[model samples]
Target: MSGSTHTVTNQPPPLVGYDVFAADRVLTEGLERHLDPGPLAETRAELTVLGRAAGSAQAREWGRLANVQPPGLRTHDPSGHRIDEVDFHPAWHRLVGKAVSAGLTAAWARPAGHLRRAAAFLVWSQVEAGHLCPVSMTHAAVPALRADPGLAALWEPRLTSTVYDFGLRPASQKAGVLLGTAMTEKQGGSDVHALTTRAEALAEDGTYTLTGHKWFCSAPMSDGFLVLAQADAGPTCFLVPRVHEDGRRNPFAIQRLKDTLGNRSNASGEVEFDGTWARRVGDEGRGVRTLAGTVAAARLDCVLGSAALMRQAVAQAVHHCTYREAFGARLVDQPLMRTVLADLAVESEAATVLALRLAAACDGAADGDERERAFLRLAVPAAKYWVTKRCTPLVAEALECLGGNGYVEESVLPRLLREAPLNSLWAGPGNVQALDVLRAVQREPGAFDAFLLEVGKARGADHRLDAAVRGLLGELGDLDAVEARARRLVERIALVLQGSLLVRYAPAEVADAFCAARLGGDGGAAFGTLPHTLGLAGIVERARPVE
Candidate 1:
C-alpha cells in the first residue's frame, strides 16, 4: 500500500443531532427519495453498491436469534469455550449476504428504509460471531492504525474483501468488520474510571502486554478489536487483532456472553485478555480521547440506525394501511390512521434529517479537530437517545396501525418492534445517553451555543435563509433557563438543520416546507419545540453575540 494523501475542502457542517425541518430538506433534495426510475433506480443503485456481501443470511440468522431464547438464559460455559471455535453456520452466511444485498437494494428504492439494511446487516454480523464485542471502536482507531506507515502494507489487503489475494483490492469489493473497545468493567457499566484492564509495557518487545477482564464486548466474534487498558500514564487504546489474517487464533478467553433482550444475535461477551499483544493507537493516556472520537462516530451510526429502523416501521405501517381493510375502507382512509401515519412520517423525517445533518457536519470538517469532535460528542448521545427512545414507541405505534398482524411473526412489525429496543439499550441506554448529553454540555459549555451562533450568523448574512434562522434563534432565546434551556437544545437541532439544508443543499421551496413543518404550520406540530426552546434559552443567554 502506497501512501497518497487527498484533502477534502468545503465540507458540510458537523451534525449536532435530530430535527424535523432537517429531514424535510433532505427529502425535497431527493437525498431521501431518489428521482431515478427503473428496477434498482438511483438511490437503490447506490445502496446496492454499498451493500455488504453478508446481508441476507445475517437477517435470517438474526430472525432466528430473535425467535430463540436469549443467550442469557442458555446454559453455556464461557470458561471452557473460545469465541473463534464457534463456527458460523454456512447457511447463515449465505442468508446474510442475500439479505444485506436485498436490504440495501430496498433501502434505495424506499426512502423509508434508508439504513434498515445496514442496521440488520450489522445486527446479524454480530450474531454471526455468537457474542457481543466492542466492534465500533475500530472505526475510531483505524485511522491511526492505517496512518502508521510501517503497518500500511499489512493493513491494506486486510481492509476490504474485494482485494482478492488473487488480484482485486478490498475496496473493489466491500469488506470490513465492526471494531470496538470495551471501556466498562465488572465494577461499572459507564464509568471509565472503574475499568481495571491493565497494559504493561514489555521492555524487550517494545509492545504493551494487555491483561484484564472486560465485562461487555459487543460483537465478541468481530474480526478486530480496540482494547482499552490502564497504562502507567492512564487509560489507553490498543489495537488488538482478535482473528489473525489466516483466520485462526483467539487469544482472549470468553467469560460468558450476555443474553440481551433485543440484540441477541451478538452475544455480549465477558472477555479475559491474558497478555494479549497490542499496538498503541494514538497517544498513550489519551485512550479516553480516542474512545471519545470512536464513541462520536458510533453514536452517529446509532442515530442513523435508529432513524432507519423508524423509517422501516413507518413504511411497514404505511404499506399495511394502504392494503389492510378496515370498516370497508383502507386503513389509510381513516382519520386516526392518517394521524398515526402523519406522526410517524414527521418523526421519522426529523430523525433522518438530523442524522444526515451530522453526516454533513463531518463532511464540512476541515480536519477532525476539537470543534468537529465537540459536535460529535454532544450530538452522539442526543441523536442516539432521541432516535432509539423514539424508535420503540414509534415502532409500537406503527404496529398498532397494523392491529393483529403487528403481533404476528409473519408481520415484519413484530420483528422490527423487537429489534427497536436494542437500539436504545445497546448504545448506552437512553438515560445513559441523556447523562452523556449533560456531561458534554458541562465539558464544553460553548459547543452547542457556538453551533447555533454560527447558524444564526450565516442566516443573517444570507437574505434567503434569514427569516427561517431568525425565527429559530428567537425561539431559542425565549426558552426557560437550565433544564428548560437544555430541553430547547433538542429543538434547535431541527432549526440548525433547517439553516444547514437551506445553505448547503435544498431548494427554496423544500426549505420552506421544512421550516413550515417544524414550526407547526400546515397542521404540523412543532418539530423541535421542546429542545429548541430549552437548549436555546439556556445557552443563548450565557453567550449571545452582540447584534
Candidate 2:
C-alpha cells in the first residue's frame, strides 16, 4: 500500500490458471499482525529489495507463469507424494532474482549483524516449503560471498540486478545464477564419495569436460550448475553453464524429471552432462569442504523456511479457531485447543529466533575462520533437524483443530501438510545434525565452552529456566568431566532461548504490552531466563577441577 500499484499487460502464452494473490495476501496480513514493527520494517525492506531487483516486466511475467497452476492442489495420488513437475514456474526464477539481490545486499551493506539476521528471517519466513527448499539453498551463498568482500564485486551486481527468467545464462551479467549440483547416481546420495561424476580438466582452454548422470537436479532445465565431481585430488565444485547468454543450450541435458513430494513449484529432475564445459569454484582438492559448507548454510535455510510455513499454518489455524464453531462455541474457546495453539506458538517463536541468532553470528563475524564456520555448521543442522521434525506434527495438530475441513483442498492446511514433509529430510537428516553437534563440541572446546558459559550466566539469573538448565546439566554431568555431553545440553537450551529473544523483540503484545503478563507472570519469568544462562554454567563447569 505504500507504493502505487502498476497495471501490467501480459503477452505470454498461457499454462495452468490460479487465484494467485489470495494466498499471498493471507500470509502477508497474518505476518504483519504477528511480527513487531522492527521485524516488520525489516521484512518490508527485504520485500522492497526483492521487488526492485526483479524489474516490473519480469515480475508480471513470473506472476502469469506462476498463476498458471494450482500449486496448492498438485499431488501424486498413488504414493501420496505431490508430483514435482507441477511446481516449476518462470515466476519462481524472478523470486530467486529478488532473494539473491536482497540477501546479498543485506549481507554486504548491513554493518550490524542484527540486520543480516532480520534479512535471513524475512527471506525464509516468506517461504512456503516445497522442492524449493533445495533451490532455497541458493541464498546460502550470500553470507559466504559477503564474508569475502573480494567475491562481493563478482556476486553483487549479478545478484541485485539480473533475473534468470529462462535459467542459467553463463554469459549474462545478471545477479541471480542457478548452480546445479544434482549429480547423485543410483548408489550415491548423502554419500557423495561414491559419486560417479567425472570432470576432466583441459588446461588449454581453462575449462573442464564433465560427464555424468545425475539424479535430483533441482533446477534441471535452467541456467548453470555447480557440478560436483571426483578428481585425483578429491571431490570439488565445478561451474557448468547450461544455457548461453544468446539462449543456446549448453551441453547439460535433461534426462527425466523426477516426480516428487511437495515443492512442486520447483523442478527436481534427472540430468546428463556430456562433455559439459565447467570452471572450478574453489580449489580442486577443496570441493568436499566447499560442498559441505554450502550444504551447511542450506540446512539453516531449511529451518528458516519450514518455520515460516509453520507460521502460515499457525495463522490459518488461529484464524479458523477464532471464527469456526464446534458445538456452539468457537474452537479457540475450547481449553484443549487453546493449549495446542499455545504450544505451537511457543515452538514457532523459538525456532525462528534460533535461526536469526545463527545468521547474526555467521554474518557479524569478520573472520571466516573455524570459529565462525562452527556456529553455522552446528546451528544449521540443529535447526533443519528440529524445525522440520516439528512441522509435520504441528500441521497435524492444526488439522485436528480444523476437523474434516482441514483435509479439503479449498483449505490451505492440506497443502501445508503435504508440503511439510520435505523440510525434515532436506539439507541433512536429523541424525546427521546430531553428529555435527557432537563434532562441534569436540573441535572447538574453547569457543564452545565460551558459548556455554554465556548461556549458564543467563540461566543463573532466572530460577525457572535455570531449573531446566540444571536438569540438562545434571543429566549430562558437569562440563569439566563430561564436556561433550554437557556442551550438547547447554547448546540446545541456549538455542531455545536465542529463538525466544527474537520473539521478545518482535510484537508479542500479549507478552510485551501487559505488565503482569510480561513482568509478574509466566511470560515475565520466561523473559528473564536466557541471556547468559549457558555462559555462566560453562564457566562454573570449566573452572571446576578436572577429574
Candidate 3:
C-alpha cells in the first residue's frame, strides 16, 4: 500500500551526533582546572573520540539491546553438570570491551589516571550503566588486593590490562581479568560484621576454604572475587578464584540471579561457596580495614555514576526543549520552563564539579598529599550520600520535562530513572553514609579539619557560601542528636562544599544561581523553585549540550 504523505513536524530531533565531552561545559572546564596541562590535552582528545562514539547510533543501539535482552544465567550443562555461567548479549560485551580499552580499569597504573578514568567513566556511563558493575569492581579490586603483596603481584598486572577476557578460566591464562566482590551475606546486608559465613583453614600456607552464601555477588562471571567470611580470627577478607591452580573449576555454585529494577545488563547473583578454595587477602581479623581502599574506590565510582546519570538526563531534557515547540514558543524559552531547566542545570553542574573534585583528591592522595588524603576520607562519604540522593529527583524532574515520552522505555530516560537509585543503595544506604561521615569526624578529626580547610578556600569569594560554611560549622559544633540529624548534617556539608567549588571555578551566573537557590534559601523544596531574579537563562544555556 502507498504510504500517506503526512508531515512530521514540531517534534525535537533525536539527540544524536553531539559530542558528549564537548557538550559538557562543566566537565570540560573542571578537567582543565584540575588536570595537568599535558594529561588534560591528551585526555581531552581521547574523550572527544569517546564522546562521539558514546553519542553514535551504534552505542545507542548497544545500550538498547543490552537492556532489552538482559543477561541469562545457566546453571547446568546439557548433561546436568553444574556450570554456573552468565550469558550476555554481544552488545554487553562490546560496551564492556570499549570501557576496558578506554582505561576505566587501569586508572591506578597511569599518570593522572584517576582523573582521566573518572572523566571517561562519567562519559561512558551515559551510554549504558549496567556494564559499569564489572568495570567498577575490576577497578576497585586493585587497592584491596594490595593488602597482600603476593596477590597484588599476581593480579594487578592483569587487572590493569586493557583487554577484556570473559570466561571462567585461570587468571594465569587470560590476557586480562575482571574482579568482583561478595561482602554482604543474607542475614546481614550492610552490617557485614554480623556475617555468619565461616572460613576453614585448609593449611598453614595462608590458604583456606570458604563455606557460606553471598547474598549479593555483583559481576558473578568475573575471574575472581574478593569475599568476606568469618574465620578463626574474625571476619576476614579472602580472594576466591573461579578456577583453581590446577585448572579445575572451583566449587562456586550460583544459586540464582537477582531480578533487579534497573542495570539489567549486569548480573548480580546469589552464590553458595561449597568449600571454595581461597587465599586470605589481609590479616585474619582486619577484613573491614583491608577492604577500606576497595570500598572507598567503589564509593567514588558511585558518586561519578550518579553524576553521569544526572548530566545525561539534563542534557536530554534541554535538547528536547530546544527543539520541541509548545504553546506557540519553544519550551526552553517559556518562563517557568526556563526556571525549571536552569534549576536542573545548576544541580547537574554542581554534581559534576564536586565529583571531579573528588577525583582530583584521589589523584592528590595517590601522590602522597597528606591533606588531600584527609579531605578525601571525609569528602567521599558526604559526596556519595548527597550526590546519589540528588540523582533520583533530578532524573525524575528531567523526565517530567519530556512529559509522556520520558516515561516510555524508548526514550532512555526511564532507564536512567531506574538506574538512578542503584548507586545510593549499592555502596550503602543514606544512613550508612551519614554514619560514616559522623565516624570520620569523631575518629579522624584531622580529616574533618581538612574538609573545612578545603571548603574554606572560597570563604570570601561569596558571602552566601561564607555564611553557609559558618552555619554548618556551628551545626557541627552542636553534636546533639547527631545520629538523628546525620542526614541533614551531611546534606549541609555537601552543599557547602559544592557551593565553594562553584564559587571558585564556575561562571558568576551559574555560581550565583546555585548560591541563591541552594545556599541562600531563595528556592523552595522542588525543582524550578529558584527565585525569578537569578540568571536562569544563562544557567540553562551553559548547561545545554551542543554538537
TM-score of each: 0.68, 0.71, 0.99
What is candidate 3's lDDT per residue for 277-347, written digit by digit as tens?
99999999899999999999999999999999999999999999999898899999999999999999999
| lDDT per residue (tens digit) for residues 386-505 in model 2 | 677777877777777667877875455776787777776665566666666656656756555545554454443434444544555565455454544543553454443443343344
lDDT, residue 74, candidate 1: 24
Worst 10 residues of 2 by lDDT: 538-547
Cα deviation of 261 in candidate 2 (Å)? 1.2
| Top candidate by lDDT | 3
Ranking by lDDT: 3, 2, 1
Which portions of model 1 show Cα errors greater than 4 Å? 1-44, 48-84, 89-92, 95-141, 144-153, 160-178, 204-206, 243-250, 366-377, 431-446, 453-547
User: Candidate 1's residue-wise lDDT over 1-547, tens digit each?
Assistant: 8876987633222211222122223333334432325422543444433333222344444545534534332223478544432234344334334333334222222333333333333323322222212333333344445434454345433432221121112222324333445556888687776778888887754368788888887655545567778888887777776654455554777666666555544456778888887777767787767655456656666666667667656655665666566677766666555655655665665666666656545533424455655566566577777676677888788778767768986666666676777766654776567656666656676666645554554454345346655665565456355454554555445445444544444443334333444443443342222222112221211111111
Stretches off by above 4 angstroms in model 3 are none
